[model samples]
Target chain A: MVEPVTIAVDVMGGDLGPDVVLDGALQALRADSALHLALVGPADVVEPFAAAHDRTRAVAATEVIAMGEHPAAAVRAKKDSSIVVGCRLVKEGQAQGFFSAGSTGACLAAATLVVGRVKGVKRPALGQVLPAYARPCLLIDVGANADCKPEYLVQFAQMGVVYMESIMGVSAPRVGLLNIGSEDTKGDEFAQKAHQLLAASVPQFAGNCEGGNLMAGDFDVVVCDGFTGNVCLKTIEGTAKTLFKYVKDALMASLPSKLGALLVKGDLSRLKGKLSPETYGGTPLLGVKGAVIVGHGSSNATAVANGIAVAATTVRANVAGVIADTVARAGSATPGGEGEAAASDAR
Target chain B: MVEPVTIAVDVMGGDLGPDVVLDGALQALRADSALHLALVGPADVVEPFAAAHDRTRAVAATEVIAMGEHPAAAVRAKKDSSIVVGCRLVKEGQAQGFFSAGSTGACLAAATLVVGRVKGVKRPALGQVLPAYARPCLLIDVGANADCKPEYLVQFAQMGVVYMESIMGVSAPRVGLLNIGSEDTKGDEFAQKAHQLLAASVPQFAGNCEGGNLMAGDFDVVVCDGFTGNVCLKTIEGTAKTLFKYVKDALMASLPSKLGALLVKGDLSRLKGKLSPETYGGTPLLGVKGAVIVGHGSSNATAVANGIAVAATTVRANVAGVIADTVARAGSATPGGEGEAAASDAR
Candidate 1:
């Protein structure tokens, strides 16, 4: 008899609001018998789910954070907000993980402030597992710290390595620093310094990986500052969407192409599935004390359910604890290990 | 009849070297009777083209800059190099423009140092005309100034607008500041400051554009620092290639899908053409005293021809003189215009 992994779900988040969130939570609960969910929202919104499932619990909250509101300010003001309360549940040890398809800024804020950072971790990076040609690769700091130092990237690499090893079950993950070019001398002062730091610190440091080779599947983990990473991720998504739209428009331009499109409909659907963010479920905010999964703001029911599953799996794997250990090991391996330890302690 | 526009071609540049360059130069000369080409390279490589075409002239250059050589060092050391000599021809009024399908770094260095910068222009930006949903958009600073200040971005926007309006024939082009978020307060310190400067200076400023909206055709000109713009451009190219590869694999997986692919071959070719970098030919190095066009290193004969035609069109339109005038007007339009002019004079 294994104990069920409990996860807190923010029902009042995302663009779709509570109804879609509640439905997704219910679907997730039904799919896994060893899974438990604490649906946090207004009483009316969450009470129905709590009453229906034996493994589900309702945690009432009155306030909701708007997507456009300043994240830190909103989190600070709305203590009873669904996002904040859900994270608080994880902080209190009532849940092993927290899941939200909400305002990304709000989720990041609450997760870092409420659930807290793992010991010795300077910043928590938002990581996404994206499908590449050969296999899936993890990209860290998709939108966490936009202005990052070389030391911060080193930490991001360590966290990414640990997450890939423990959660994705990859041994000795190859870490690549994302830069403008593959050469060591490429990029600006920050990227140059970061490359040197990563080369000295990380065990499986593969040199620089250009943005063009990101989907080539040559790297297991790619580390970059949030600004560049965010642009890279969104560019991929946008270009994919635009390309498909262009193809569809081209196909429907004439009768022969329309017939061709009909024949390959199944293949196209499969291709879409491979490229869809929902297939990967949710992105994990690593280096936090508790497992935190942030889904797309426009995620559907399937995506939300998958996000919950990811949260449960991450919690079961104890990713937070593993990340802490990995960062500590990486710190001790460097010549300035003692200084790094002292700085972390001071923080 | 209008007087013929003379442009310099780096006959020894690109992967295919002199053969493809000479062939493409001949094709351009044949296509446009009013175009004259100065083929600059070793006598053995360029003399044949000069002898074959009445309008083509051969200029002897003894040295070639390899793609891997350090850009500044190569430009300084190889005084008789084809790229340096080509730019020198343009600088000395023998040619109105210079074109190369060779090392981008070398081209940039030679163009900046030899061709010179427009008066009052701080830095030259590399601008590429990429296809969007509705029309083509000009992306500036693709690889010119990697680490750019906010003022540099403002200049880029001004240059991008002028290029799009005069060359692409867009009236009052909408300028967009490329950032991770659409909000004014949503980027790093650099982006935030650049946004403010652009909003105040650019007449058709469209506010901040997220990476995802880059291909949506919502803006006519998108501006970013060289690093982010380079990454964004490469990411798009890489993603498009990967997606097409994925689609081809999916189509060939089964007989029926393969048949469907055959039926849509024409449509597929059209889609590929729409996404091909070759369709746009070359990226113009804006802000230089003379027009300088940089083509892809892997350019085929047809692509090379298109690049030469682009150079001819840019020269005919007097893009460099117009850019200088636009910058002078923009500098004076701002309150600190006198100080900027003083700084330029000092430089």
Candidate 2:
């Protein structure tokens, strides 16, 4: 039999509080027989639950990081916070992975500083699976390095290819450079330089993919600077919500429409379930030395459970090790070790 | 009675060619008795239409700039092209404004190089009216000025304020700095600096606006660097299209759902209309010495007519003069003429 995978869960992280996280952790434990959980939180909050559950232990964390606190400073100062403790568990090899639905910035900071980065990796990026209409697409650097150089995007594409291939079973995943236009020289200076590097370095490089084509599933992976990708991701969410709300208001305006809404409600709900962020669970912080999933702040119990499963899956795939080896190989293949040079300057 | 307003229409522009633009120009003439049109295109295409319609005249142009051509090069090389000639009309004071359903890049280039930027304005920007669920919001720098400094964003907000005030009749329009987070110090260096400038300079600064709040109608004007703004605008369109397509497919899956779709078809169509880009006519290229509207390349005849009407309205409102005055005033007010120093470095 295979060894059981252990994941550290930060119970103090989301808007819904520890009760919801504890319930989700229990649900995940029940679903996976071989899964062990390290519940990280305040002593009183985690001790009783750990004692009552099998294959579980409580890791007491004395401090709590507020959502509004500065990320780097908070992670540095709040050494005993749940987020930091959870990362420490991964660093100490007590847990194979970590999951949290807390402040995304705080999670990123803790993961980068505490868990450390993979060897030769410049910067870890948040790679999220967007629910595209035709098929799911992975968008990298969603909000990690907002001010990115060309080489950073190349690394993001490489890491994304690895994750999609290993986890999503996408073979030779087609990659596209996200830009303002489809032309090779469409975006600003950074995009232009990135496009040239992507075409040269990435074997599966497709031409530029405009924002309108992001959800069309023309490319399996899309790489962009974190700022643009973040805006695009949020814009997609806002658009869907706004459109659906308008549709509901329109349906209620007439009797026939109201009747119609009832008849198609189930089908529409199913479609929504397919597109919901809860299905994806969380965004993986790729290039970190250990698996770390950043869940949405408003995630429910189901989403939290899904996030735990994702962390386990990521551990099983050995994503961090694969990334480290691949990046080292790529760096050696370059004429003058450009990748290492770039990583040296990384934050 | 007010004096007649004349707008130069690039009949050769757009996917459908001169036929749709000619028809729309004719329709606009019929709808408003005091509105005249200068149809700019090849002799064969515009001469007959102008001869057949009252208050319409054909302006012969020997060349046409295709969509895929480099914008700046095409505008310079094809000096007699319909797009260039249309801008030339505004430059020579033959027409009050220009409208085109052609290449956005070409339109932006011609407007900047030919019609020229307003004195003291660093860069002219494209400001599109977004069909927000609650109300319309103006998004500036949608595609122009791809690489923007914080000062350029300040100018964009100032220009947006003038356009929203004069055209949309918004009083003290609320301006927002588009960023990844809502916090004052959330985004990268550029966004943080832009937020500070916007808050200090804009009277109705609404702080940092996240992507999710874009269409919520909390802010009347949202300003971003051109690259991010373009991606956000296109992402919003893509998401709306993708979601509706999914809804339609879901509704067609079962017999009852199909019936429901039929019943709600009219109401849904109305909602779609309310969210459609065609309804917005065109995005105005703000901060130019003369008015220029960039219509969607896929614009139909009615959309073309709407664009022309928008350009005429922009001219009537003296938007160019208002922006020039506001920017000039803001520039002089700043210590040590910071605005002028920044404008000198603009491309």
Candidate 3:
């Protein structure tokens, strides 16, 4: 029999508070018999849910980090906060992974500081699976390092490949560097330097992928600096929401359109389900020592449950360890270390 | 009586070549009695169309700059290219503005190097009017300066204000710095520093605007470095296209859905029209001494006609002169000149 992977859930985090998180955790526990959850929050908040589930346990924490608080400072000061405590559980080997729909900054801070970075990894990246034309594409460094060096992108690409292959079940994922244009000479100095390094090193490198081509799903993995990636991600999200709203408004403008809307409502719902953030569960903070899944702050119960499932799956695949191994191998293959060489060249 | 505004149209440029451009130019001339076009291209290609319209005249240009060629090199080597000649018409006071549905880089290079930058303006920005929820918002520096100094953003805001107030007719346009977060301290060094400068100098500074809030039309002007703006613009384009395609596919999945689609065809057409790039005509290359408009290479007759109309409107408003005046006032108001001070501080 396979051993159950214990995943720590931050019940006190997220906009919905502990109640929604606890309910979601219970749902996740019921769905997977081989999964275990440690619901971390105030004793009174987590007890009822923990007592009802056979594979669930309660881990009490005293404080909660506000979404607007400075991440590192809050994590350092509030050692008993759900986010910090949950990450600590993973660090202590009590849990294989951590899941939170909390303050993204806080989760990133606690995960990097408490659970720690994988050995030989320069910077951890936030990898998100987005719906595209042909298949789902994984975008790395969505908001980890806004200012990035060329070597950092190289490592991001490696981590992305590992995650996509192991978790998403894609073989030899095609990697692309997101830029303003398809030409290698496009973009800023940083992008130019990164392109050269990626072309030289990353075997699956597909050259420059323009922003307009991202949803075409021509490549499996797209790497970009956190700033551009964040803008792109949010732009897509905003555009999708706005477009749907526009379409709905148009559909309801007249009787004929209203009847049409009623008839096609099911198909619309299916499209929405496919495009929903919950479908992808959460973005993984790859290259961390343990599995760290950060869900949308406005995530519902389904999203939370999906996030926990993602955490469990990532833990089972040992994504962090694989990333470390990949980085080490790449570093050894290049003389004087790829990171050092890129840094020197940049200087 | 108001005198006609003479505009130079690059008849040889664009994907469809001279025929489509001339057809569009003739249409613009027919629509507006107070508009005259100097059709700049090979004499043989433009003469037939030019002779057909009372307000149209042909100017001979011997060479054409390909879209894929390097901008600066091509402009230097092909001095008699249609793009260069069109801008030269504006420079020689033969035309009040120049329009091209050709290579963006070439137009930018020719406009900056030939027509020249307004006095005290450090960088000329590409300003695009995007349809937003409340109103059309102007996004500046879409792909001009990939690597930007904080002061350049300040100038961009000033230019945006001028364009919005003079052209878009927005009274005291609110300008927002585009960043990952809305916080004052959010984003990278450039964004944070630019936010500070903008807040200090720009009268209508609306603080930081996140990417998701862009389509909401909360701010009149959204400013960012060229790279992020380019990514955001293209991502929107790609996402919109993908979503529409998905909707179409869903509608065609079954007979019932197809019937519903037929009923709501008008509504769908309206939605598509609102989101179409052709609706905006072209993006104005702001801060150039003379009006220079760059349209999409795939522009149709309607889009080309709209581009010509936009050029005429901008020329009548004297956007470049107003921008120069605004910059001069801002520069004089600051003790050490905001640009120099910000540049030194950034260094």
Candidate 4:
């Protein structure tokens, strides 16, 4: 085994606070002995759960981030809050990465403002790696920055390709722009411009993948503006839920269906595994200084464990450094190089 | 059963020409005795399909509309083209409606330019019913007009609810503005203004439904600017395909999984039936003065058949006349009320 990679966990995040978070962290550590964590939250909140099991030197604590407050304000105001403090540890190099099931907007802000944007990175995209046939395909900008320029999308494509190749071990991943139709003349000015920039600038252009091809798994990485990506991601989630509901209703609608359901229960769970976002666990906030894994709001122990695993994997892969270098190269021809060039200023 | 609605079909308008269209029209006619069709196509090309099948007396003929040519250019040049000819029949009351499994853009232009927009409708919108658990949720302005003001979305919401209530017979249909989040402040300028406008203007303002809720059976109808709506609609299509691929892959991953798939095949097919866009088949161009249905380019016999069925249903429901009357009422409140003045002005 390699050196144990330490992660900072937000014990006060989610509907089930310290109990679930502590339990999940402990479970994760058990599953992967190389895992170590800094459980950030109120000492009193985390103490009971920590004491219930053997209090190992491997675990640490800070303070909790409240759920009720505004994300941008809370991260700045309560620097000692679990999510904030936890993120700070990674920033200071005390922890290899940070994992939080807290408010997504807060996590995004803290990571960008505190961890900082990597050099030449225009936008810190939130990349969701969903299950694809054989290997997973990365869908970038799920709900990060809503408005994006063509260059940002190009960078996202490059960043995404790098993540898939380095982290997922998929070489020469086919990158596609998400659009209404697969035709060249489709989409708005931004989509059209992004297509031009990507085809001209990026090395691997998988042509254009229509929304239908996205689910068909014709490409390895699907890139789009945060707004479209978020919409696409959420629509998939909605459709899946609708499909599942219909399946349930159908099974209960008839006696034969009930028998079939019982017989196929195990298979159904496995099928669910294929569809579960938790199976992939966390999303990496790309183009940040330090590793940050964002888990789903309703994420359970397995997903939480996987989130820590992903963070560890990302650290080992040195994703941030690679992203910085990639961005540096891509923007070298343009004005202020990659570093110190304001992201908003570039577009 | 319901006074079989007579619909005029542009048989030669689709990509596959009259062969698939002929197969589909025959199926629909056989299935419904009340339906009569004006089959418009190249008389020469259509004869073979007409000869092969036991011909129905309801089928009439018009000349051809090529698939590869510019939609508007082709229609304009070939005034006797199948699509134009079919709509002309409806215009002259030869057939009560028109359906084309052809170029969507062409059909839209034809409806607006030829048949004309319904009186007082701001813009002619496309209403495509997406599969949901309860039934299907209607999404307006899927790709009709790329750029739209807030008022367009408002009108779409109003008209879409009426379309569902009167035609699909959903009473007090929940109208949702397509938005990024449920929060009032979560969208672009158009969506923001639309949120406020819808709240005051529409009686059953169901607040907002995010992309994920589009097919979650949360709302009966969803409204948005054409640009965003098109993007969102495509996103839904793409995400669903991605999920479909994942599920199929999981089922075929190994022998055990394959065995599970065999056992649950029935349930799986049923799930697919519930979500497949093919089940809904054709999308109706909602604000036309006469009925005009546009099916998918890749539509096979089922979709084409459904397109015919939709055309028949739409005419029976008198969707355009209802919208025209509704728009007249809505328009008369503020203006000189030359019928369709605002609609004509908006266009």
For model 3, the superposed segments whose C-alpha errors exceed 4 Å read A1-3, A334-347, B334-347
Instruction: Judge candidate 3 at residue B166 and give its lDDT.
Output: 80
TM-score of chain B, candidate 3? 0.96
Q: After superposition, how far is residue A250 of candidate 2 from its true place, in Å?
A: 1.8
What lDDT would candidate 2 get against the real structure? 0.87
Show where candidate 4 strays beyond 4 Å: A1-4, A31-34, A47-69, A334-347, B1-5, B13-20, B27-34, B45-70, B231-271, B298-302, B331-347
Index of the highest-DockQ prediction: 3
Q: Could you give candidate 4's per-residue lDDT for residues A88-122 as a string of tens digits?
A: 88889888788888878789888988888888787
**DockQ computed for model 2 against the true two-chain complex using alpha carbons:** 0.56
Query: Between the candidate structures 2 and 3, which one is better when assessed by TM-score?
Result: 3
Please rank every candidate by lDDT, starting with the best: 2, 3, 1, 4
Better of 1 and 2 by lDDT: 2
* Candidate 2 local Cα displacement, residue A124, angstroms: 0.7
Candidate lDDT (C-alpha), each: 0.86, 0.87, 0.87, 0.74
- TM-score per candidate, in order? 0.96, 0.96, 0.97, 0.88
RMSD for all candidates, in order, please.
Answer: 3.3, 2.4, 2.0, 4.5
Candidate 4: which docking quality band?
acceptable
Tens digit per residue, CA lDDT, model 1, B1-347: 75689999998888986889888887888899999999999998788768877998999999999989999999999999999999999999999988999889999999999989999898899998877887888888888877766778888988898889888899989999988898888887677767877888888898988889888888999999888888888888888989999988888877778888888878988889878887888899999977899998888788889999988888888888888888888887754433432221110
Off by over 4 Å in 1: A1-3, A335-347, B335-347
Show the lowest summed lDDT stretch of 10 residues, model 1 chain A: A338-347
Give the per-residue lDDT of model 4 (tens digit) for B1-347.
57866687777656675678878898898888888766677666556655664433234444455555666787687677677777777777788788888778778777777888887776889888988767678999898876555667767877788778866779889999887788877765446666876786677788988888888888988987665677677767666665666556656766666665566667667777656666776887888877788987777787889888878877777888888777676664522323222221221
